[model samples]
Structures are given as C-alpha cells and as structure tokens.
Target chain A: MFVTPGYAQETAPAEGELQTEIVHEEGHGEAGFPPFDTSTYPSQLLWLAITFGLFYLFLQKVVLPRIGNILEVRRDRIAHDLDQAARNKEEADAAVAAYEQELADARAKAHGIAQTAQDAAKADAEAERKSVEADLERKLVEAERRIATVREAAMKDVGTIAEETAGAIVEALIDRKPDDAAVAAAVGQVR
Target chain B: MAEDPIHQFQISRLIPIEIGGLDFSFTNSSLFMVATVVTAGAFLYLTTSSRGLVPSRTQSVSEMSYEFVANMLRDATGPQGMRFFPLVFSLFMFILVANMFGMVPYFFTVTSHLIVTFALAMIVMLTLVGYGLKTHGARFFKLFVPHGVPGVLVPLVASIEVISFLSRPISLSVRLFANMLAGHITLKVFAGFVTTLSGLGAFGVIGAVLPLLLTIAITGLEFLVSFLQAYVFAVLTCMYLNDAVHPEH
Candidate 1:
C-alpha cells in the first residue's frame, strides 16, 4: 500500500505539472500535499529519530545539569543572605536597647546630683541667717550696758556740782559756809 | 515569475546517498533539523555558561524556559515526572526552535511534516507504555479501566478508553503538524496575494494592502503559536507520563 501511494503520487504530479505551471498554482493537486506524501516518510522519520535522540542526550547531560546547578546555587545564596540580614537586624536592635538604657541611667544620676546641690545651698543659707541674728543681739546688749554706765556717772557729777554751787552762793551772801547737815536739812525743807 | 509559497516546503536531495536500499539522502529538512539542534544547543549553552547568581537577560530567558518546563512536569505528573525532563525539554526546545525558524524568510519547518511530528509522538507514546509497564507491571492495564464505571458497561468503556489511548500518538502528531501546516499555508497564501495583487496596477496595489496587513498580523500570531504549540506538546507529554507514574487512573 505504501509503495502504491508513492508510485501514484509521482505519476499524478507529473501529469498535472503542465497545467499547474501554466496557472502558477502550487500544490493544487500535486501529490495532494507534501506533508501527506508517504514517499518521504521513512527518511524524515529516520532523521528525526537520530536528531531527537542526540538532542535529548545533550540536554540531559550538559545543559540541564548546568542550569540546575546555577539555580540551586542561587537559591542557597539567597537563603544565606536573608539569614544574615535577620541576624544583623537583631544585633542592631540590641544595640539600640542598650543605648536607651544607658541614656535613662545617666538622666537619673544627673537628677540625683542636682537634688543634692540644691539641699546643700538651702542648709548654708539657714546657717548664715542664724549667725547674723546672734551677732545683732550681742551688739544690742553691749550698747545698753554702756548707756547705763554713762547715766550713772552723769548723776554723780551732777550731785557734786550742785553742792559746790550752793556753797559758793552762801559765801558770797553771808561771808560764811553753812554746816553740811544744816544745809541738807534746809534744802530738803525748801524742796 | 511569482514565487511559489509551497516551494518553501519542498524537500530536495542536497546530497543523495543510499545504503541497503534505503534513501538516507541529506535533504533541506535534515539541514534545518541539525540547525535546530545546534541553534537550541548554542542558545542554552552560551546563556548558561556564565552561571551568574544575578543572571543576564539571556540567562534569565534560559532559566525561565527551564523552570517553565520543570513546573509543567511537576504540576502534571508530580515530582515523579521529573525523570522525563530531558525528553520533554528536548522535544519542547526542538519544536519551538523549528517552528520559529520557519517564520524566517526561507527557513524550512521540520515540524510541519507528518513523519517528523509522528515520530516524536511515537517516542512519547512508546515511552509512556514502556515506563508504565516497567513501573506498574500488569497493574498498568488499570488505566483503560477507569474508576467508578458500571460493571455492565465496563467493556464498552474500556474499549473506548483503549481506542483513545491508541489515538494519542495520532492526535498529538496531527495537532502539531496540522497547526504548523495550516498556519504556514495561510501565511504563504496571504503573502502571495500581496505580490500577485500589487503587480496589477493602482487598484490592485490598494487591494494588496489588506493582505499585506493580514500577513503582518499572521506573522506575529505565528510566533505566539510557535511557542504555544511547543508548550502544548510538552504538557501533553507530561500528562501521558503521569499514567506511567500513577497507573491507577
């Protein structure tokens, strides 16, 4: 049957060749169609088998392995990078936490130091006030004592002068001094 | 003389050689097939040669293609389907390159031929059968007998299942071949219209504009189809392999 088809195709196309050329019509009835022609089947099949087999081998051995390796390596590298990034992020977070803790501690210590200085200044002010008040009180008392001594001295002098003036007056008027007791009695009476 | 669109697909013997009554002549199809292999190989090799952790643009493309097929296999057949990565990946890359290469001005599309695509489909089918038998032994037959079928209707269901199973290779191969052939043919026909219409004067030139735009649009779409068809082929291969891995369903 295959042989018959091949022979028939060859003869039929030969007969129709003249008319087909005249019309410039291609594949109108020549062997029906080239793809359907059985004459070329064996050769085409043979070559396809041979070429496909070799191509398959090339792919399996050389191309696929190389591609697989590259892809695998790339995957592994990406995973490794992601893991490293995660670790670095954790380290950065820890550092930030430590820095914040130190900042808080320093602030607390500074606050404590400020509180101590303020208390010291307040105590010093209180001690200075008390000392100043005591000094003022001592000075006031000494001035009062001095005034009393001066008053006593002035009273004694005034008494002596009064006695002398009275005696002078009596001598001028009567040419004689009176007795102390009499004079004292008379002055007392006049008073 | 108008260039023939179908002439792009013709297979002429570049170096005719016969051995033991077999035609082993190296044709344009063979040339492009080798070119596909080399192009795919060089692309993969050069892109991944650096193996940078941070990939270049080409490396990213290479890696994306790898992961795309890898994910497809894993999703369809689970982790156990990874063993067929080489087969599925090679088939995907080969078909993808061949389809895209055909979009160039004068490149031959190897996947457009039934024999080539059928051979690839047969390989996938045979692999499924071989692996299923090897792994599951006699229990692999359970695939044809699906779960939750009525006992009375078991024979009918099983026969349908068997026929569908047998048709997998045909369907898979035909899907790729037909899509490529139809798309290439459509593109060629539109392009021919552009050339033929433009040759006839002012009115014909204006008429050619629509076909020219269509050709451009189709070329862009064909690029998408080129990639998508390869993806479909690989995914189907993975699904078929799932049966080998888990033969119960």
Candidate 2:
C-alpha cells in the first residue's frame, strides 16, 4: 500500500529516485528494512487505532466492572461479618454480666433472710428465758410468804397449847380446873 | 526455507483497500492486531462470564490482569489516574498479546514496527499534554521546573526538563519496538544457524544442537521480554498520566 508513488519508491528497492540518487540509502539498499518502510505506516496506524479503540471500549464497558464488583462484594461481606462477630461478642459479654448480677442479687437476698431468721430466733429465746425467770421468782416469793404465815400461825398456837397442857396437868394432878390467866402469864414470861 | 533473519519483519498486504488517496489495506500486521484483540477479549469475556464469587484457575488470570494494571495505575497516579485504566489496559494487552503472537511461527509481530509503537506512545503523550493543559493550564509548566534548583540554573534545568519531556514518547515507543524487533531478530538468527548447520551432514547436526538450544533459551527469554516490555510500557504510561494530574511536587 503506497501513500504516493514517490513514497512507495523509497521502499521498493533502489527504483526511481533512489536508483538515481547517490547509490540509495544504506538500510534502504535491498528490500528496505520493513519497519522503516513508510508505505505500510498508514495501514498500521489505521488498524492499530481500530483494534486498540475496540479493546479499550470492551474493557471499559465489560471486564473491569465485573471484576471490580466481585472484589467490592467480597470486601463488603468480610467487613459485615467482622462487625457481626464484634456485636455478638458484646452481646455475650452483656449476658455474662447479667448472669453474674443475678447471682449476686440472689446471694444478697439469702444473706438478708438468714439474718432476719437469726434475729427472730434470738428474740424468741430471750423472751422465753425472761418469762421462765419471772415465773421462778414469783413462785419463790409465794412460797416464802406461805412459810412466814405458817410460822406465825404455829407460834400463836403454841401459847394456847401451853395453857391447855398446864390446865390438863393441874386438873389431872389436883383434880381441879387451874386458872387459864395464870398459865398464859407463865408462857408469855418464858417466850 | 527462508533464512534471512530480517525477512520475518517484512510487511505483506492481505486485503488491500485503497479508499480515496490513502492505502487502507488489511495486512499481516493488521491481522495479528485483530488477533491480539480477539484473543485477549475472548479470554477475558469467556473466563469471567461465569462471574463466580470464588474464581477458578482461568478466572484468576483474568482477575489478576485486571488488578495488576489497575493497581499499577493507582499506585503511580493515585485514584485520579483511575480514569485512564481502560487506555492503559488496552495498550498492555494489545502489546503483550501481539508480542506473544510474534512467537508463534508465521505470525507477524505488530509491536516490532516503529509506527505502531510510536503511534501508541503518541496517544499517551497527547492525552498527557492535553489533559495537563486543560486541567492545570499554565501551572502545567511546573512539570518542567523542579523545585530546590538555584534560580540561576532554572533556565538550564528547565530546558533539559523540556527536552526530556518531549523525548518521552520516543523513548517509550522505541523501547518496546526495539526490544521486540531485536529479540525476534536474534531468535531468527539463532534458528537460522540451526537449520544451516543441520544441512552440513552428521557432524553439522551435532553442532546444530548448541544453536538449537540457544534458540529455545532465547525463545524463553523473548517471552519474558514480551511481558516485561508490556509491563514497562503500562507503568511509564501511568507515571506520565500522573504528571498530567499532579503536574509537580
């Protein structure tokens, strides 16, 4: 594909101007190094533009988006999973804390119950001991009063019995009723 | 039968189409360009068509390529350069596949041509210059004027910087073109030696083994060169595009 007859002549191997001009160029001597061959440039440029354009369009429209989406989705999934795990750990910690608090509350309630029972038992035992002591003291006082009354009664009877015994002795010995006033005076003097 | 090491670089017209005054012929170069696109496109399309969340072996290749270029661009130019990913990716795949195609016997290597690589390089430069001027305007000139230089040497430094900036396309294009051209030529020469030696009888065949081994080793090296050149091109493109966005420090 020749751009111009002159341009084509440059690469056609020492023909036309090149044949007439100074023994032709060194690299351009024989078949001409093809890369330097200017005639083929137009086609190469055109096809490169076309193919490269198509390739750029295809990649921009299709492949990149797909691959980018996959990576993005995976990153998002991983982040979400990590967040979920953190939340789960926090919730588990909260549950453990709640369980510990309930156990502490139960322990405190049991201690209070035991303290109230011990206080109540101590009060009951104190009341029972006081009542029993009061009952014993009352019985001892009543017994002491009964004994005093009996002793007084016995002392009062002793004068009468002494008078009676003296009269009986006088009556039995002298066959007569001796004077009660005399016996009483004599017992009083002896007491 | 063809023994000329340089002969492999010849261009032949396939479907010669002359429209108006221009020759728009489909050629061996063009055929391989189309082949490069088709091969790359079909591979990506077919592999990713499944859209598996967990990729298979083939699917991983498609993803790896996409990520490789994507990361390379992002790293060079930050997120601002992401917009040019399509252009960079296309260039990479096209060059890489074209180079590989050259390795297949009888297939033309498109990247070996100066015009092809120069045109691609020109595209990158044009985009860089165009975007830089449009976005940064006169401030884009800051790219040539590095900071911390003594005021007296500013002009000298800037001239050097300007010359370097202007030569970016030349260096970039020539790098790919030369590597492909030289590697193919060297491989051809070694292969030619193998054939020429084998024709000299039993002792010749024995001697041919060394060259034949050299050809195989060169072929392996050529494959590495192919991939490396493509990668280098893409990386340089990113750095240039980065210049467009950021302009200077």
User: Cα lDDT of all candidates, in order?
Assistant: 0.84, 0.86
Task: Report how far residue A13 has shifted in candidate 2, in Å.
Answer: 12
Give residue B138's error in model 2 in angstroms: 0.7
Candidate 2 residue-wise lDDT, B62-172, digit = tens: 889989999999999999889898889988888889889988998899999999999999999999999999999999999999988999999999999999999999999
Cα deviation of B109, candidate 2, in Å = 1.6
- Candidates' chain A TM-scores: 0.47, 0.63
Q: Model 1 off-target regions past 4 Å?
A: A1-32, A107-191, B1-5
Candidate 1 C-alpha lDDT tens digits along B1-249: 133445556676677766776667677898899999999999999999999999999999999999999999999999988999988999999999999998897789999988899999999999999999998999999999999999999999999999999999999999999889878878877887899899999999999999999999999999999989999999999999899899896
Give the TM-score (vs. native) of candidate 2.
0.84
Scored by lDDT, model 1 comes in at 0.84
Q: Candidate 2 - CAPRI tier?
A: acceptable
User: Judged by lDDT against the true structure, how good is candidate 2?
Assistant: 0.86
DockQ (0 to 1) for model 1: 0.23
What are the fnat scores of the candidates, in the order listed?
0.55, 0.62
Error of 2 at B210 (Å): 2.0
